[model samples]
Target: MTVTTRLAAAALLLLSLAGCEGMSRGQQRALSGGAIGAAGGAALGALTGGSALTGALLGGAGGAAIGAITR
Candidate 1:
């Protein structure tokens, strides 16, 4: 994705997550981890010229698992 597209997506994501105040601790952690992972994965994928969607999926899954397992 282009720089503008990525920035717009990030902004939208942040706005969407702003409503998660009612979620439990674990749920919040998982969501936060997934979002962070997906962003990192997408960046890595883009830098490596791979598939950003696939990277985001895999990363998000891994992150959610880790987050769920934590305190």
Candidate 2:
């Protein structure tokens, strides 16, 4: 895999562990979703000639929605 993918995966793993360790459900979901969204955005951005900042903003907004709706 590429360096970006590797780093994203590592970040996700760490976030997962953090989620499992005493974090409230809302906080965990928000954090996890944000991380996932940012990673996904970065990947998609590179592929679609979009700005990473735009991707990240969109991702974070979507993540917040998902997180809020989950619990």
Candidate 3:
């Protein structure tokens, strides 16, 4: 992507996070963990030439479970 596209994406992501302020701590953590995990999983899957969707689904589930438990 171009720099402008990346910057716009980042800006939108940050702006979207503002909505989380109304959620509980646990919900926020779970959402954060899921997002992080999905991102990581997609990257890893791409690097390993695996199915990104599967990896993301599994990673997101595990991350959200851990996040909810930890909270």
Candidate 4:
């Protein structure tokens, strides 16, 4: 995988770890979704030769929305 994808995945994994520490359900969902989305977007972007930052932003937004709605 590319640098952007790697970075994003690392970030997502780290955030996921927070959920194990007794964080609020909403907070955990939001964080998890945002992280996953960012990583997914970055991976997709890297494959398509797109901008990592843009992918991250869009992913974060989408994730946030999904997370909020889920809770």
Candidate 2 displacement at residue 65 in angstroms: 2.2
TM-score for each of the candidates: 0.72, 0.62, 0.79, 0.65
Candidate ranking under lDDT, highest first, comes to: 1, 3, 4, 2
**Per-residue CA lDDT of candidate 3, range 1-71, in tens?**
89999999999999997889899989988988888888888778888999998889888888887777794
Which ten-residue region of model 3 has the weakest summed lDDT?
Answer: 62-71
Off by over 4 Å in 2: 1-22
Which run of 10 residues does model 1 get worst, by summed lDDT? 60-69
Please give the lDDT score at residue 66 for candidate 3: 79
Query: Which is the leading candidate under TM-score?
Result: 3
> Candidate 4: which stretches are off by over 4 Å?
1-22
- Of the two candidates 2 and 3, the one with more favorable TM-score, higher being better, is 3
lDDT agreement with native, every candidate:
0.88, 0.81, 0.87, 0.84
Clash totals in order = 0, 0, 0, 0
CA RMSD, predictions in order:
4.7, 5.1, 2.0, 6.4
The TM-score-based order of candidates, best leading, equals: 3, 1, 4, 2
Q: Is candidate 2 or candidate 4 better by TM-score?
A: 4
40: Cα error in model 4, Å: 0.5
- Root mean square deviation (Cα) for candidate 4: 6.4
